[model samples]
Target: MSRRVLIKTLPLHSNYGGILQAYALQRVVRDLGCLPVTDTSKPLPLQRRLRRRLWDVRRGIRMSLPARFDWRWRSAREATASQRAFIARHITGGSFVERAYTRRGRALLARRFRTFVVGSDQVWRASYADLPAQFLDVVDDLDGDRPRRMSFAASFGVDDIAEYRDGDRARVAELIRKFDAVSVREAAGVRICRDEFGVHAEQHVDPTMLLPADHYRQLAARAGVAPAPATGRLLVYRLDANDHLERTERELAERLGVPSLELLPTGGPSPSYREYAQNRSAYDLPSIEQWLACFASADFVATDSFHGCVFSILFNRPFVVYANASRGASRFDTLLGIFGLEHHLTSASSTAVDERVFAPDWASVNRVLDAERSRALAYLTANL
Candidate 1:
């Protein structure tokens, strides 16, 4: 029997959370004694390619602005160098099959791999181009010999399917019904899978939480470059900027009496992460290791990022999440609810920063994490 497992996920890119989740899933699969490969090959539609080229022309104009205003500019390749390096070193086995593959080509893939695993991100979300591919429709196209299909922590990125077009919802519903097993990252996803898709799904923690803090700390240590030690510092990571962020940061810093280290070259937590890549100079962009290190070393953390909240809990750093409604607040709700830390979520308009926000019960949180980690790993072992 072929032990090769093809993981269908959002293409690995500069987003720290997305990349780390991809890495963590592959790592978990390797430990489970299967050869895991992620679909890192991104195939953009021609229309998108053309649109991107047009954006590139506008970005060039922006890049040409005076150093006083556009000082952070660096080629995208240069900015993403460290992130690419980490992926190359730790994450491997890229599958490049596109939608245009021949029947024979897909048949060959069917024989070569026996299991297709999808998830640990918003793989089910409608905004991404390859929704059917994420659902393992490529494997279904193989006809007589189809591999087992399973979703591990897949997400819809929204609470309901009302936002999705009728055609997309019906198509997604049809594709998802064929899965051997389904699991999602958020509780709302379970409801969606049941009510919308008419398929049962278990809710699991994100793959990043499957590994121990020591695993990430070792990754940061070996990566050779890190932001300066954030020990005793407040780490502020925000994907979306709002009028209230500055005041929130100021208040947190003042209350904590610590300097703040903000993750930068910032523009995302976007579904496509293209905004971050397009808008920032490479020099201003932080490496994946640097991003992980901030969580590892920080005394207190504040952010509107879901993964930021995940890492703070993973590393047991005292943190507050400034709920990012645009990026799916349900993700934060589900994740924080799992650990009984729902109080950690705050907003720009939220005036009072509770004393408890600065102090999560690490002992209790770790207990929950340990139990949840066991459940997650067991799901992989049983299903795969």
Candidate 2:
């Protein structure tokens, strides 16, 4: 029997980490001949899903596709029927809420899903958090049959689980207990799952980094964005309203004396990453292949995203990630620590360093990651 994974993905919101996580899971599932189904549920309700779907359709109509593009063709179509069902649920009204619970039709559809995966992002966050929708705490209901319970790479955005009051912690632990195996994307998350939620979780690199950078380069080459010329250009990707991002980038650009491609971004954590594609110039958001090619092309990279930093390291693109006053830095710290990448981050007020300064014998990182990936694959495959 094929195992059906009901995946809860963070809304695409154009973050590369979210995209990488979903695709990585799909790739691993494909290797196993098991279907991976996605359900992009944030903390929104049915009405919001309805509103968002309408908005997405309007955006879909206004947006032009890449030349030789066909929306109907999908790498996921070859997935199992269960996978298709999950996608349908995920794509529903652009909200997983409407797909699974907001509507009678979708609720009926979700009832048939046997195995569920709670995460690859911040799925445990409550409604008060900024996520678009919340998981319905159905782990208990789903656990009744003792179904194959697992969590892929759940992340809690903040480290202080103590901030929650009014029994939220109880709900969180209750929900976490239903899982048979657990893993998290960050060090704080590993701590939270063990200390707060009472689940033992191993730490792993983001799935996007699991595959080599060359693989993404091939994808980019297929998509047709030529490698960036060696023009000493800096690619700047920042979405947060960090007070000093512009000043730092400007300072860095002037110091490097290279024109920078600033990615002007817009969008929340939603189901479509088109927000990234939309806010960013078409030049910035290339196809996966082209994105990799550009990674190859960059003389240096500057950004504050985890996956952005990951690709930079994968290509050995010299770079630095300026820190933001946000809570998600634990994942950044964990991954960087794993690779001994301590020099890549600095506080916003610090003097800007040339991004070309990265130098580490990634030889150690490569060996550790390769071994971990192999063990993770063995674990996932054996349980299935």
Candidate 3:
């Protein structure tokens, strides 16, 4: 069988977690002695693209208003330059193929790559415009034996899929059942696969956790990211903004006696709605290496992002998780549960910060991480 493998996951964009997970997976695969190429060829459907453009246009009109206009606000492309550059250098570049769903495309893919991996993110989520492509449906035309199909840490993103159309749910179930092996990132995902898709899936840590913190520090060094100067700063990385999360951040900062440093704006209701309010430099994404350095150097961390929590734990940084119910709270529940730090999960309404988060038992946490890392590596080695 050809050692070349193709990876299918959500398209690479500015989401730090999404990009890192793709890079981590490809790195792991290459270390296991296989050539991995992520498939970035899939494009969003015409309708989805149109809807996004319309939303952008409306936002542009609003930002253009005299009261809201800021001369320093940067364009989206300019803001995301560092992120896209990292993707080109480490994740995907000229490897992005044209449409691979046609008959000829499938034959070429089968001939070129022997394995297809479809996960480590919310690729199974029903609302994605390109749901079939994420499920590796492009290979359906080829004989099953030619290309092996599997998913590592695939996630549905939400516990419930009913919000999406029934046809999409049924089709996803059908496609999931055909995979040769399956693993999920969250505990709830295991249940969802068994109950909803009638397929049993083992649970594994997110691909990011499979690598140690030293690996990221080295990567940051190689990228010319300066070593973080010692500081008493509370790093706050949240995906969504609400009064509760704001309160939590304030309270945590008070308890830690450190000033808070927010890297991303968790806009009101939407992640990007308040983008114009910040200066142009605020909009520029920190290089992935710098992002890692933040987690590594923080005295205390409070975030609503799943990857934020993951990095905090990986770096052994004392931290708290403000539950992000929208993105999927189950991800937090399962992750914290594994290391017996469930008390660290807080909500918008929680009255007090957990004293436990101020001082985690790093010795115990590291032991659990080691075990989980070994389990995840074994799964990849055995399956791949």
Candidate 4:
């Protein structure tokens, strides 16, 4: 019999990084014959004061426009530029997105599944306005029966946890110890869990990369992305740099006058809303593969996000990771170091301006990926 595992995530607001990770996990879990169930939290009617706070988080903290209505409902309005760029490069046409959360909705999810597995992304991050803490407790949900629980490669970045207190950490330790297994994507996460939660975490690839880079190539081919460009001078967004990164690239484009394209991840301001539901998260917007053709045709890469860095490595494309001094240097730094490709990396201040592809070890990266995949599979199988 298949184990019914409800996959939980922070409210999906249209993030390719998060969507790709979740989709890849669901896909692999299914391939492994593990039930990959979708269970979105139901939205609740916010009091006037509470609504304002949530809106601030959705827009202020993370720069996302929280829809006035439910976020679980998928819609077709165009996305912001960063989201569009993400769509053009990694995800395909929008499908399987969500836009609303309600108490009734949460009830449906609880009724639909038994066990729950959370994260391959920042679902645990405080970035989300209504965290899954709504669904979790120091030991269990404050009132509801607990689902069988585990966290697969989840992260809160390099930040410390503020929610656990009043012996809550110990209570969470109870929850952590109850898990059949746990895994994390970054070394920092490994350290954090061990140091704070008393759970020795195992390292695992983001589920998206577990499938192999060639799989993405095949996906592109299947989706009709013709071929890699012939002249080959693709400037991927590896820099953790911000608008300045764009400005620098613009200058480079002017000087080189060669064909170039940029893959921007979703983040930033939202359109004016007629109401709360007027805007939606990028993850709720569309799939990156819809525009994967753009990246498939790229000659090289640059990016700041961890998965952005991973995809570049997966494609064996020479890429530079812009150290974002803004976000306390992404966890990307730690993961890249783990792979021994540390030399290919540079921080935002590095003089490595618009660096080109250097010799990289695809064989070595894949070897590491394979082992990580096995470790992840082992955790899942043993738990089931």
Candidate 5:
């Protein structure tokens, strides 16, 4: 029988990078000769769900006030609908454990899987750190037959552990010590694991980097993404859209002489919940597969998203990165440094788009990527 692994991370929702990373992580696990399953269970209780709805309704009413009315909220809701449709169509190979938070649910999960893997995103951030389920605490407590616990490319989502509250830091440290093996996505994460927790953690590339570019190309094709433009097109994917980024993209498009396209439904945790709730639009949001196709089809890509930068490199497209300081800049810095493309990094304040032109030495970058891949694979094989 194949060993079964239950991989848990952020829920699959509107976030493109989060969903794609979850998919990529499963693919990598399966490549290692194990069955990887995502926990798609909606663990929130009915009361919590009701309370959430009431909160959203209340917020929506407030936002609808004549003085506060904004149209972006409508766009957000429409984008969310499109995102859900995309996930339903493209995401597969997963099993759901209903009511996974209950005693029976917990027992069912323990009975069904032998290994639990947590990570590939900011699962270790302070917001989720206190949650026992995120830490696989129930699995750890399984009597005499606990499954192996490991983390792959888990990130703290910040440059320092000090960013977490004192109580949260201590709790996170305690939970992390229970893992059989731990690998983080950033050098800063490694430092935190060592300096704060006294646990040494190896840094690995994001799971999205484990697969080849062609793999994503095929996914795009499956999603029915149209062929790339005959000449070349400038693709802009900015997670945090601002006037500065907008100005930069327009300038780049003018210089390159290619039609530019912007991926919509773009916003992050920084936006108010009420704003996102009220946003509704008919603009079709691309599925994760379609999103990959966007990158694959691009002649040049520009963005402030870490995955945007990663996909640009994976597709070998010339690209520029605007630092997303709010989301965490270390992720971009660390990944870019690995490929020796730190020169591509720029700030929103800078007007020039590094006009010298991008010509990455793929041969050297791939060599470094290969070594990192081996390290990541070794960690999984040894721990699992």
Candidate 6:
């Protein structure tokens, strides 16, 4: 009988990457002869939620005042519905557990699963890292009977470990030390683990890359994505949009003589841009399959999202990444470096639209990807 593996990560919300990664990790675990499950637990208490909300609101205010009241709320509601539908359709193993934010909640989860896997996202970020539940601390009282602990592609979401408070840092270190096998998503994460926590960790690719490209193609086909456009268009999946990026995209599209289609961030549509007056918006929050299909069908992609760049590479489409510093630049650096596509990374101020057309050496890129896939597979199989 396959061992029951329970995964703990950020909740499946509007974030496409987070949802897709969770699905991918589940697939990886199942392929390794283990049953992978997730906790469909609800959000924590009102106090915690309020605190987190306040922090997020503060951050949004810092970034863009308008973002605080954009169509994101409606878009997120739609996106959440779509995400739930996708999870219901694709992920088959787990059943929803009640809200599990407290000590009792962790105990209940420990009792249900023999192996607890934490990873494939920034679950270790300071904001969410302090929770004992995330660390599998509920099982600590079980003594020798404690469940197996492992992490796959977990990220710190920042370059430095010092981003956490002194107490949080110590707590996180202790929890990490208890993991049987740990692997991080970024090279900086690997260094942080080794240099700061003294825990040796292997660098692994994002879970989305664990599956082959054809897997996503099949999903797109199932979703009924239209065939590639005859007069191909420029697809823009900008998570953090600003005037400069918008102008650059328009300029690039104009130069390439292609109509532009912009996939706005989680919320709703932004103010109209004259540059994109001829452009279109994928305003209806698309399902995960549709999202993947959008990337597959695009002639060219311009994005600042980590997963957008990821899918662009998967489809072997010509693309450019406008690195979003606030969202975490290290992730882009690590992923782009893996495919030897560092040249594609550019800043918002850059007006060099012509460089976006350069074709990547896919053969060399695939070879590196294949090797990394095997290593990630080995880590999952051995640990699980």
- Each model's lDDT: 0.80, 0.60, 0.80, 0.57, 0.76, 0.75
Error of 4 at 170 (Å): 6.2
Q: Write the per-residue lDDT of candidate 1 for residues 1-384, one digit (tens) a residue.
A: 439988878877788889999999999999989988887655456687678779989889986775345534544545677888888888875654553266666766766677888877877777754756677666666756656889999988878766677877788889889888898999999999888889999999999999999888888888775644788888888777776776778888998798887777543322123444455542446778888888888988888888888999999998888878777778988998989898887876677776787768999999999999999888889999
Report model 1's TM-score to 2 decimal places: 0.86
lDDT of 2 at 45: 62
Q: List model 2 lDDT by residue over 1-384, tens digit each.
A: 666656666665444556666766766766687766666645446588789889879767644554224322321222123333333333322334334443453554355556656566655545324322333354333322555667666677667565565577776677667667787777888888788767888766666666766776765655455666433678776757675666767777787788886543232332134433344332233334444555577777778777678788787777778665364666677777877777777666577564426455667767877776786676667655
Local accuracy of candidate 3 as per-residue lDDT tens digits, 205-264: 899998889999899889887777324899988777678877888887887788999867
Worst 10 residues of 4 by lDDT: 91-100
lDDT of 6 by residue, 208-306 (tens): 999998999798787676545312778888876567777778877887788987665333354233312333233346678778877888888888888
State the lDDT of candidate 5 residue by residue for 195-284, as single tens digits. 999898989999998988888888778767775632377888877657777787888889888888776544443244355545522244
* Alpha-carbon shift of residue 98 in model 3 (angstroms): 5.4
Per-model TM values vs. the true structure = 0.86, 0.74, 0.87, 0.71, 0.83, 0.83
What is candidate 4's TM-score against the reference? 0.71
Supply every candidate's count of residue pairs whose N, Cα or C atoms clash at under 3 angstroms: 1, 12, 0, 43, 8, 3
lDDT of 4 by residue, 197-297 (tens): 78888767677776766666676676555556423655655434466455555545555565565454344434334422443452233345543444545
Stretches of candidate 3 off by over 4 Å are 43-74, 93-98, 265-279
lDDT for predicted candidate 5 compared with the true structure = 0.76
Worst 10 residues of 3 by lDDT: 265-274
RMSD of 4: 7.6
In model 3, which residue pairs have backbone atoms overlapping below 3 Å?
Answer: none
